[model samples]
Target: MNENSHTMSERPHLRVVHGNPTDEEVAALVAVITTLNTRDTPAPPPPRSAWSDRRTLHRPPLPHGPNAWHTSTFPH
Candidate 1:
């Protein structure tokens, strides 16, 4: 008959295997995330009497080329 029917008749259908993880897998993942979040410990605070200096943060300037000024690159 049709080519699609002929191909289907020649090939064997395969069954897909799918299943959910056990409770142990879920608990192990949760324990890993919890350990990661609490791994870093904060240091003690500096002396209250000592005076700290404040400084301004600056970023480097970008290149001024033709492509840098393109209109399509940015949202309208």
Candidate 2:
């Protein structure tokens, strides 16, 4: 027997332990369960918005010295 084999093979064997289920019903149940188990992780949260970000709200100390007020408004 192959070392990787479990039960009779590598695959898990499904059994109807409670009820006599038809093959198609068992297949549908498997499909639903597989889908639930393997669902894609939720898309990562959307990237943070720049305007609303806390870093954008940060302010540098007010400018100082001669003509500071005027130079402050103009790009350095």
lDDT of each: 0.59, 0.78
Supply every candidate's count of residue pairs whose N, Cα or C atoms clash at under 3 angstroms: 0, 0
Candidate 1 per-residue lDDT over residues 1-76, each given as its tens digit = 7655536458634322566766787678678878887887676787664243232243434546677767435643
Model 1: lDDT of residue 28 = 81
Query: How many angstroms is residue 16 displaced in model 1 relative to the true structure, after the best TM-score fit?
Result: 19
The residue-by-residue lDDT of candidate 2 on 1-76, one tens digit each, is: 7765676455666756797989899999999988987776566788977878887677766789999988789753
Model 1 off-target regions past 4 Å?
1-19, 41-76
Q: Record all residue pairs in model 2 with backbone atoms less than 3 Å apart, i.e. clashing.
A: none
